[model samples]
Target: MVDVYWRIGMHGDQSTLRRRAETRGDWAPLAPGHLAPGWGDGHGDGRPYLEHMADVARAAEISGFVGGLMPSFPFTDDPFAAAASLVEETRTFRFMVAFQPGFVHPWGAARLSAALQQLSGGRLVYNVITGGGGPAQRWWGDEVEHDRRYARTAEFLDLLRRSWAPRPQSADGEFYRLADAYLPTDLADQPFPEIYFSGSSPAAIAAAGPFADYYLSWLEPHTALTEKFTAVRAASQALGRTPRFAVRIDIVSRDTEAEAWEVVRDGFSGVDLTALAEGRDGDSVGVARARSFIDGPVRDVRDLEVEPHVWGGFSLLRGGPSFGLVGSHEQVAERLNGLVDAGVDAFILAGVPHLEEAFRVGDFVLPRLTHHSPQGALS
Candidate 1:
């Protein structure tokens, strides 16, 4: 059974993929003399973004989506705070919070996670992101080097797991030291949140082996994914552990192929071809690999299609993952099923104006998927 999850975008989002008149975060009239909605002027800052997030979560839950991946980015709201705000959002919709382990100490993180897991009844999943070395890390005043970050993360997880022990646990590591450390009985008894680890470097794969419940990566070429997943599996096996695989991808689905293509075609015009495709220095092999799929983009957006149903035009309109599934509902579902067959057990999917798209995908794309149910649910 494959897990189908929607992306709960914490930052501002555009209504559509088009960038010419992009009204990120909120909505407004883009054209001269265009009539505005009656409710438009009434909302000064529009509604609180959390209200919008709840609407999306509710839609995703009712639509049969397993949950939503709450991403952590510099410009986004805190995933922990955002998830807490939606405690009453949906009954079973999980919050897969994407966060850099460096930002919080393992013990503190465990306590916060335990509180939410208790409140949400085990509806918490951790998307553990080691900071990609660049200005972003500097923005947070982080001084750790690229490879050492993963080492610290490995240590962090080691201590984090130890923190949940029924008896006090102690640890002395390069990055952390704990003496007779343990959670309170109530918090310690809370279910552990599954860790979905992401990274593409050698250090990353090594660090993920022992802790990752799901070895996660953004969507890459299928062959590339096969090789990477194989390495992660080997790493896990060496330690007598097994971990499932997941991919995060964007989606563009419509009733017909032409309709879907039309969206990208319109979005292609808004792309700044020069900046969107250029490769820059980064410590993350994953970020570099994601950008690598679009080999020598010249004119059209479809040129970035590394494979069928896979289009690398996402950065043209918004930030985040560049490659995504772009086709009719059947076509997108077919491609998703293909990934499942290739060993992917979960997918973190996103689209613009997350509120409406959650319903669109839940109604159209999700039903067509073959592995949408979990293994326990199967006869």
Candidate 2:
């Protein structure tokens, strides 16, 4: 049985509306030598920060989602701070907090993870992000090359695992060096939070193969996903470890297939071709893969039908987790079942206007899926 998770938007923007605004040229274009336009100034359609986070957290918890993934980005609210605040608002729901290794020392990461695990009663899961491109990396003053960043992340994870040991730990690496580094209190009694790693580059797979408890990827076709699974499995097998596999995707489910397609059409109506073309100028492998779908046979929004209920129109505008599943409740379930059959052990799903979509999928789609019980909340 594959576990399902939802994304909590930490950027403080109504995703659909924000995209719509961009399409209508409501925001300014990039200035000379600028990489991207400024976003999330709280000017577009979005709930107040506190209200939005609280509403989404409660909705995800009550909807039987296993957890909610809080993304980390230079343009958005700090995920660590957001998760800490959300902990006091919800009960029994886990948080997958995304973080980049280079932004914080290994000791600091370990301590924060331990503290969150204790505070949440073992409900913290760390999503290690090595970042995507040079532009975003430069924002954090990280000048390391792509492959070296993965190497640093591997060392970071190694030290973090050791820091959670019953006793003090020490490590000396090319990127980081620590002596007698340990948490203030022993975290051995409490289980360490699971580590979820995501990357599509070779260095990324090599780094995560021996460490990550789960390997996550943005949504790709089944054949592409199968190849990725094979590569990761081989890497893990070489290290005598078998890590779980997961994917992040968007969903648009309604009572009928036509209704679901209608939602997609409306969302696609806001597409900004100019912005989409500019966003593809990045060097991120994930971004390139996503843009590939848009540049391929998917000429128009209606041509985004990739596989069965899978839709690629989201890829035309969004960078990460661009693929969306659009269909009736049963059809969505069927699409998910196919991915699960293709070796996906978990799913991180989201939709526009997150709160409403959370309940819609929770009420209509989850109950129809096999290997899932909607009777109780996630433990």
Candidate 3:
């Protein structure tokens, strides 16, 4: 069996999600901003903030999609606040909120997640980030060396796990301190919200053992994915943990393969070439990884289609997860199957002009995916 997920709305133009929904079919839209470039103004104030996220969440439910990803960052709307507002507006649609160790206290974070879980009736998913962008780090006043952030995150998650346990948790780590902290709420029946993390650093891989329900990855070819997954599994095993796999991807779907490619080509027009270059130039692991793809043996970032039905053009603008699955319904299904064969269990997929892309993917791709095989969501 295989599990395939899609996220259509990501912070972008105001009407991107709605327009996509109207033209295509019902699909999920991840809230825009936080990590999206060109979103925050020169003053570092984010536009299309909570209002845009609420609209996208409302539209996703009304229009018929799964859920949205709520990103956490000082510059954008708070993930918890954004998700809390959408609880009543959406029915089955859930919210995936991003978090990092350095930003909030572990006890406070656990309490926040518990409240959200209860309010949304257990419709909360947490994405753990290790602080990537250099500018974003400056906002939090966290200037730890690259790998150290992951080390601190591991400590953070350890405290978080203990906080959620039946007995109060006590921890005294270099980065965090907790003394018999325990949540008053009882969630005996409903499970705690799932945790997600993505990183290629050795420390990040090593940290997955402590707390990770879903291990996330950027868009990579099948061969690269195979190698990465093998290493991640080994790391998790050494730590006595079993983590599921997921990949973040943009998508281009159409009635036929040719039509899908046409949509992919059209998306290039929306790229902010100047901002893209600036973001790429910033000192961050994401930018360096993107440059390696473009400047190395893969001379052109555009040549990053390591497998059929996968494209890396979006990586040209952003970092971390910068690839898209491009093809017709069936072709998309096959590519997804290839990833499943490589041990990928979950997918956080999206597309440009989000609204229409959501419908195309949800209506066309999801059904094919379900028919091909069906599996449970991230446990």
Q: What is the C-alpha lDDT of each candidate?
A: 0.82, 0.75, 0.64
Scored by lDDT, the top model is: 1
lDDT at position 83, candidate 2: 85
Over 1-379, each residue of candidate 1 has an lDDT whose tens digit, in order, gives 7898898867656677755443544344433322221134434433566776777789889988889999887878888898988977679999988888788887888889898988999999999999877888888778899899999999999999998766888888898887887888988999999899999999999999999999999888888888999999999999999889999999999999888889888988876787664546557787688777777745887798888778877877677877898899988888888888778899999888677788899999888888553332111
Ranking, lDDT, top scorer first: 1, 2, 3
At residue 90, candidate 1 shows an lDDT of 78
Query: Estimated TM-score per prediction?
Result: 0.92, 0.87, 0.79
User: Which ranges in model 2 have alpha carbons more than 4 Å from their true place?
Assistant: 15-48, 294-299, 316-319, 372-379
lDDT of 3 by residue, 29-116 (tens): 3333433222334433333444545555655555445566666656455676767877887777778888777888998888888877
Top model number, TM-score: 1
Q: Of the candidates numbered 2 and 3, which has the greater TM-score value?
A: 2
Error of 1 at 374 (Å): 20
- Please give, for residues 216-247, the per-residue lDDT of candidate 2 as tens digits: 98887666777888999999999999989988
Residue 316, candidate 2: Cα error in Å is 4.1
Range of the 10 consecutive residues with the lowest summed lDDT in candidate 3: 17-26
